[model samples]
Target: MIVAEHLTKRFGQKQAVSDVSFTVAPGKVTGFLGPNGAGKSTTMRMIVGLDRPTSGSVSIDGRSYSSLRSPLTEVGVLLDAKAVHTGRSAVNHLRSMAATHGIRRSRVDEVIEITGLTSVARKRAGGFSLGMGQRLGIAAALLGDPHTLILDEPVNGLDPEGVMWVRRFVRHAASEGRAVLLSSHLMSEMALTADHLIILGRGRVLADAPLADIVEQWTTKSVRVRSPRAREIAEAAASDTVSVTSRGNGYLDINGATAAEIGELAAARSLPLHELTPTTGTLEDAYLKLTGDQVEYKTKEVR
Candidate 1:
């Protein structure tokens, strides 16, 4: 388990992270999400003792990372896959990392096979592709068989098959009671892999809740309606409490009303409805709504 209490970070005059607090417990995958420069990377660095927090504290399993007697066996980290030595082979790199902790050579080979690097185990690190580099980083992280895993964009350069493998592997690790903290820009993947979410915006904790609760609290569920008289239905559904938008081509998106409500309104108005489908709130929708005001950079409308 990882606990962060009132964590804050500063770079000269600017504050990168401000009084953020969250817990990543064992047996569940917790996703850390944020927009560009929202301090997600900075916070992760502090957790692993790479960067110092200006205030407050972070601990893994009730002990600070620096205080851990065997840091590798206690927490696994993959902050930067490209930070490896270019001269060493994949197998040699893992072996060197293992040697520092007195890990057996068998364990080094185990991670290489586990990460599917057996084919290129002897290849120089600089010669590997982005996907291969990510695999090597994961291999090194697993070399220690740590109880807690912290990964940042583990699927960044992976193929679809590699992505699915990571999803399953993280879930399986959590099932074995390991604490898993993951960060990713891919909302769809997070929706599938994460049991809980910790959202950051402008260096502050915007939300910390279960995936379902965050979606329910921040997003408005919508209903999709298809009909020949789409404009008429939309006009009728528009109200102070309801919102309706035309999608063109005989489709309307309705919010603040359920499928049953839409169907009843269509029936009462004698408007034949071909489809009335309710869409559950998605993680992307909730994230955008909550961080809409917090985004530091905004794109101008083309028009």
Candidate 2:
């Protein structure tokens, strides 16, 4: 398990992270989500002792990362996939990291095969594609067989297959009772990969809850209804309990009501209902609603 208590970080006059706290437990993939410049990288850096926190503390299994007897064997971090020296081969890079803790060379080879980098393990990292770099980074992280994995944008440059590989890997790791903290800005990806979500905006916690709970709390549940007498149904259900929006061609999207409710209303009115289906808001909708004002950049459309 990983615990971050009142974590904060500052760069000169600007505060990168502010009093952030969250727990990444074992047996589940906890998604660390935020917008651009929302301090996720800084927070992850502090967790691994790469950047000293201005205040508060972060611990892996009750001990600070720096204080761990075998840091690499306890917590494997892949904060930057491109931080390696380009001159070195992927095998050499893992070998060097393994040397720090006396991790066996066999473990390095094992990780190479596991990450599917054995085909190009001897090639210079500089010539590798972005996907290959990501694989190398993952291999390095798994070299020690650590119980906790901290991955930041692990699928950034990966193809569809690579993305699926990462999703399955994270799920498998968490199922084995390993603490997995995955940081990413992609809500769609997080929706598929994370069981729980930690949303951050403006360097503070916006929401930390199960994915279902977050969706339920911040999103509206609604239903789509289609009827030949759409106008008649809208007029009949124009009450505060229901909101109706026309969807063109005798269709409407109704909120604050369910499919059953709409069906009953149509039946009572003898309305010719063609379709009625339930619809729930997605994680992207919830995230946009939560961070609408906190977004750093907004694009303006040309008329």
Candidate 3:
């Protein structure tokens, strides 16, 4: 398991992370989410000892990453896919990494096959596409079969098949009692893959909770209704606990009321209903709401 206690980092006058504390337990995938400059990468770098924290501590299985006698055997990291040697072949690159930790060539071949890079094993890394580069990076990370994995944007530039593979692979690793810390921009995929989430904004943790809890707390379920008498139906549905909003044309967005309730009300009023659909809150909805005020940069609309 990975544990961070009041983890803070600073770069000269700027604070990159502040008093961040969380546990990435074994047997689960913990997603690290944030805006563009929300300090997600900085924290991950600190966790792996690439950047020292200005204060506080981070440990893997009761030992700091820098103090691990065999770091590769204890933790696997894929912070940057392009950090490899551009002039080396994929096979040679893996070989060099394996040599650092006394890992065998057979294990390298195993990861190459597992990551679907066997065909491109002899190709120079500089010639590989973005997807191939990501695969190679994953292969390197898995070379030692570490008990803990830290991946940043593991599915970037991947095809649908590759993305699904990563989802399944990470879950399988967690099932085997590995600690998994993942970061990604794809909210849909994160919803499907992560069991827990650590949300950061402007160098501080905004939320650290289960996926379901975050979605339920940050967004509300709503019912969508379309009718010629939408205004009328909305008037009838509106109450102390429910809110109805016009969504243009003959559509109404009703919150705090179920589809059944709205349908029954419309039926009792003899109102003609074209459509009545219930929609649940999604991860994207919750993420946008949680980070709405924490965005570091705003893009103005082109009028």
Error of 3 at 46 (Å): 1.0
What is residue 210's positional error in candidate 3, in angstroms?
A: 0.7
- Give lDDT for model 2: 0.91
Each model's RMSD to truth, in Å?
Answer: 1.8, 1.3, 1.7
Candidate 1 structure quality by residue, lDDT tens digits, 194-256: 999999999999999999999999888899999999988998899999999888899889989
- Work out the TM-score per prediction: 0.94, 0.96, 0.94
Residue-level lDDT for 39 in candidate 2: 88
**lDDT measured at residue 297 in model 1 versus the true structure, 0 to 100:** 74
- Whichever of 2 and 3 has more TM-score, that candidate is 2
Candidate 1 Cα deviation (angstroms), residue 192: 1.5
**Candidate 2 segments exceeding 4 Å error:** 301-303
Which ten-residue region of model 2 has the weakest summed lDDT? 292-301
Count of clashes, each model: 0, 0, 0
Best by lDDT: 3
**What is the Å distance of residue 259 in model 2 from its true position?**
1.1
Sorted on TM-score, best first, the list reads 2, 3, 1
